[model samples]
Target: MNTTPVTSPVSNALAGWLATAETRANQKNEPAWALAKRSHAAAVASSLAFPTRDEELWRRTDFGGLPLDSLDPFAAVTPARNIDDLPVLLLTRLAGEGANTALVAQTDSEVVYEQTHPTLVKQGVIVCSMDRAIREHADKIQSLLGSLIATDYDRWTAVGEALRQGGAFVWVPKGVHAEIPVRLMQFLSGAGRLAAPRTVIAVGDGGSVTVVDELLSENAEGASMYLGGTELFIGQGAKLTFASLQDWSRNVYHYGNGRAQLAKDAELQWIQVMVGGRMSKTNIWFNLDGEGANAFVHGFMFGDSRQHFHLHTLQRHLKPNCTSDLLIKGCLKDKARSVYQGLIQVAEGAQKTNAYQANRNLLLSDQARADSIPGLEILANDVRCTHGATLGHVDSEHLFYLMARGLPRVEAERLVVEAFFEPVLERIPLESLREQLREEIERKIG
Candidate 1:
């Protein structure tokens, strides 16, 4: 690891925060192993320099305008007293009526609430805060944490891994199948505060589970920042469905890294939704490391005002007879901008691999901008790979036709926008989640 210290807004702030976190960890008698990981992560973070616009991954999204120095990494803020106090629509979408699911809610830096169904516990499923898991389930935690997306993957990842105060850990034992989803919500509150959350999920052989993770804010205040990471491990013949929704305040800057590893005959369905934030960048990666493994990755986003969103995805096939499909869609209005980059890679000896990727963007305003880039890397001869991207404005004829049907111009345009996303939305498995997303998209378009 690089040992030379760097001087920058992000690095300096993180260094100061690391010291405070270490002291707190010691005072709280946290696990030594967890603390050691944080210490190592801090060193890695200190040695690296902040990302700049020159980097290919960050070339289109500039973070220079962000007021990073003003944010407080260890700020103390109160979380919502109860789930009832949260946005009704959001809670409804997550917990549905009479749903028997495990739920976790966090604010700022700690998990304020957690609950798991009795049957799930009886079946040996574990769902709780990462802190608790680290202490009580050290064996399981130690085996997977930092195994996929290492703590030192990047500067922000290091910051999150070292300083994250709250998150969730979910595990489904062998042959156990969870009928309902596991839900986690992380809400940011107070101005100038920084929120870091980490999530780890593991599904045992022949087990199945679904997860819904959300990032939201209490209210729009001064500028804030959120750094988060998620890792998913699917065992042989296991199935996992994961969905993540990000809806931070317009004054917040958000960065996230999500990754998944699939074993032989395993299946994974992943969905990502981005709708809020002043500037946001997220990377999603999937590795098919076992033969007969399959995955489907989907993403949706709507940006208005001056918000900016950058989303990148990678699908890697490292074993023969594996397949992966990916689709990302976005709509931008006003002066909003979006950037999407996707890659599909078939490693050597990974024959009979099938991979597909596509990205589509719709610009609602002349001032709106969208950049889409799709790439492929194939080292195997008997592999099938295809990628494509499209950037276009809303169809004027479609809008005019709707308007002529006695609907107002705004309503007509809204309908057109909804129709454009119908294909992607229909792909979602959960009916409640699909409807909730549709409602949110409609609300945003209006």
Candidate 2:
């Protein structure tokens, strides 16, 4: 137990780290407002201290030996001149054939490759890196970049904004339908590097779009970290489906936060999938702010070896007649562990709000562990809110029955685990994504 005490953000160690990060921020040569935003974010981040084990939110996940201030802020990368120069690992991970309406590839802090379908271009869709968006579409992004997610909310978020490098920005014009998903592949190849990517997606009135964002890495010789953030805004009567998959190598520590807001009669489908990382913590929130708005949240995690996963979710209803539903399932093998916490809150005057949440975990080995906490707070009189959590191992009888049918023990267990996650998989609208998730799970189980 190395309880030397967590260092404060204002400590000399962090001040040095901030200076390193600021130097990287200045290298971007962005506009004046963008530079000012980064400086302001740095100040805000400095005011918040790092989370200690004493904090309720971080009590379960151990943070020992994690490098918070000693990391190389941003390792330099040779920018890819074109798509052909992109890494093969990244190119192979693209969605199934013809499944992507646009593709964006990133290596470290550079956007290496970007392409959008001609149809999408004609429909007034904007898909490009954050740098280009700030230069070309500042009017649209100025008000919404950090609006939904406040910089000072937490340690991860505050520092994420200050140090975030390259990110993808997406916009769907009113009434346009980007039916095919857009894929964003971000890969960190630098050892001991700290990578932070911020993404924002906005859909105009009556529009719809689907985006698949993948945060991944190749096998690294040394440990690294990823601080990521995402913000989504769904306009009136619009629809947006956002799927984020975290598959960093086991040598990475991952911290991610995302917030989404829905307008009147809007629909949002939020999906989170976790499979890699030595340790990971993710926070997600969905705000139903207009009457008739609805949101569906889905998440799944598979951990093996000594991996640790912590997932937190919030479904908030701020207007009458708004509805939200959430379900998250996870499976662990070896000495893996997971912690899940979820909350459903209905604010005052949010009458007729309907909300539901559930977290289910399955342990494959006796050494595996899972902790689930579900809660609800309702200030409205006419709201229906419910939450549930379940933790269990594979049913012996079910495995025996499968084995009796001439199946091997390992095969039987795989069958049971696959069936456990089938419900959530069936809800995914993209076949390619569902297949990719299954493939990743199979790799983990084996």
Candidate 3:
């Protein structure tokens, strides 16, 4: 293990936790390289300060009182004995998805179950726990672990790097196509706990795959925090479809960061749904690094009570002939509040680049509020870029039209909210999953 410098900041919350980095790695039976990585990240994290409201991205959300020093970073859970032993919230969300090509489940910070189809295994497809991948596929993990998102990006990422545990990893060989989706489920419980999970996915040239990531939590008395990160790498001519849904309990604070890099002729479809948690902040980014690369993003959220949700997105064009589009819609009621910021940036030499961004919000209560900010930065003269945003209350004409019929006021409002998100929901490829999302959105409306 590397020696910790005496001059590093000792007042940071993660400084004390860094002292046990090596011991925790050894207890988990991790390899020497893994321990070395953890030690290096811990040393860096100890010097970094937690985020504050001064930063532009952090201005809308504040996590200063999250009780990081009191939470147990390495709280553990026993492995499940069978599928029936998994968290009920996770099982219920997966009820109508039918059969998946592969499935991985995590409870608290432990990976309890992993199942992959035999055919996918024969085709050189790999889907398993990140811990198993670190031991079995050390070479690959070593090369791509921090390739897309750096370990020292920010306070949350730095701490997550040093303390992340029990995640999922998926790899698809060249020229193969997985018709069904690969499912990843996570559930967090207990108070005064911190759950940090990282997922890495790579698709070889000419390969294709779909992934569904879900997060849930059981009710608890005290507050808990969830920090998650995801990285996706698409090779030349490859395709990837990703869907993420988060529904943590009211006592949980959620933070997520997701990014992807696309090669020449690559394609990506991204979908996001956020409906739960007392306060949440999320960042989604896509880099079009290769010519002819294309991407489309769709996202929606529903908030009620005193929930606060902040979302940010970036569409970066680094090569010529690249195209991207993004749309995010949200609804808020009661004392709920939301903030959305989106940017489309095009590099100097990236000509013929086409990009678009739009954010729309609906206020369902007098006290509800929302803010939408959309911008563009195009250095290329021949590129086409545009953006638009709208924030308004529910259309009274539409509500009155439905109410004049036989529907009640509450039911009319529900229908209007559902219709507002219909465009985004229609993009989902799976019918069963679409219906499931609809049901969940309707539940949130109430």
Candidate 4:
């Protein structure tokens, strides 16, 4: 075990690595087009300071007590076993289980496995490794790839763009709906290394596609960190359904976000499932530029044993007749804590916009804590925008009712909490998935 001991953010090792990363971005042989992206990303990442107590978001969260000095990235991870026939976690619910869904798997910044079902491939559906996309369809991919979450400023975002490897690039051509889903999974198998994960998805006019991104640590080993960022574009009258399952080891750090655009009459439904990670932060934002666009988003998170999961969602309505409703709820136990902040924005000309956001949490123990903030910004007088947040301990009355049924105290509390969350889980739309997620939560709480 190479326990050199992790260092603080200010360590000299991190400084040197940052410098080298900049050099790597500016190297020759790199096409001129990607040159600016790498250079700009490097420059931004070079000056990034670790968020501190002074920062509103970082004040409450700590990065696993890292050293005051920066630490070097760990060795790259490798898979020990093949995943040819593993039961797909959430995607198995779709019609064409393994036949129609495309898959892209990667480890330690290297694409280890990538396969697209031939049927979907022939449908003009593009599902392949992002690295390959950058090489084959550079022009089309480059134009819309990072447009949502531009790496021009944020340090982490820049690092992800500049050093990103082993991710997926998906494009659904006009009027084509993959009757089956296209799935992308990332496995961080290397020892304690860092993986920059990036995903770019573009849906053409009247096209529809469902995508699921799953991140897991192979065999639940290693202390790896994955910084992932994704961009989504839904063209006019298109529909895009995106779901993410993040289940890393308990000692890893995971941070990511989704930047999306919805053209006229485009519809997007996004669901997020949080199962693991010692500490995680996720940010998602949607631009409702097309009239009659709709976004239905829901999130489920479970935390335990000093784990922390923080999420922030932004809904931006820039056109009339756009509608968005968000519901995110979580449960905490074993000294774990989490926060959910949702923001909804309606522009001045976005009359008739309907935006509603809600976040609720149920803490199972006194030691567990949850903070929720739901906010709204409306500049249109004719818009209906509402936001609400609720934080409370497990319902004692519900527990009492369960206990009255002869259930033990611990069991009663668990039942009540489960009952409280079933409404949200039931909305998942997939039967097997809904039940499977229910089991995961049951296991988590028990």
Error of 2 at 213 (Å): 0.6
TM-score of each: 0.93, 0.94, 0.94, 0.88
Could you tell me the lDDT of residue 254 within candidate 3? 87
> Per-residue lDDT of 1-446 in model 4, one digit per residue for the tens?
67787765454655565566556545524456766776666667666755666766666666645432322343454532434533343234333454445777776666666778877878988888877787788977888766788775355577676666557899999999877677787766534667787788999999999887777765444455777889999999999989887877685678797888999999998988887987898889999998999998888788989889999899999999999988888888989998887889999899999998888888878899998877778888998888887778877787788788899999887777787677767655456567777887888887
Each candidate: what lDDT?
Answer: 0.85, 0.84, 0.84, 0.76
Q: 1-446, model 2: which lDDT tens digit per residue?
A: 66777756446755676677678657756777877777888898778877888987889987666766556656677777766677776766653343345877777766777778777888889888877888899999888888888888777688888877778899999988986578888887856767777788999999999988888887776778888888999999999988888888898898888999999999999878888898999989999999999999888888999999999898989999998989899899999999998888899999999898988899999999999988888899998888888889999999999999999999999989988877877666667668877877877779
List the RMSD of every prediction in angstroms: 3.7, 3.3, 3.9, 4.4
Where does candidate 2 clash, by residue pair? none
Candidate 1 stretches greater than 4 Å from native: 1-11, 77-99, 400-404, 427-432
Off by over 4 Å in 4: 1-12, 15-30, 67-100, 218-222, 427-435
Residues 1-446, candidate 3, lDDT per residue (tens digit)? 99976653325456666666567778988988878877777777767777788888888788765666667767768787766677777777778442454888987777888888777888888999989989998877777775676667777877777877878899998988976578888888677777777888889999999998988888788878888888998989999999888778887888888999999999999988888888898988899999999999998878999899999899999999999988899899999998998999999999999998888999989899888878889899999898998889879999899989989988998999999988988877667678888998888887
Better of 1 and 2 by lDDT: 1
The CA-based lDDT of model 1 is what?
0.85
Candidate 2, superposed: residue stretches over 4 Å from native: 1-13, 95-100
Residue 105, candidate 3: C-alpha displacement in angstroms: 0.9
> For every model in order, what is the number of clashing pairs?
0, 0, 0, 9
Q: How good is model 4 by TM-score?
A: 0.88
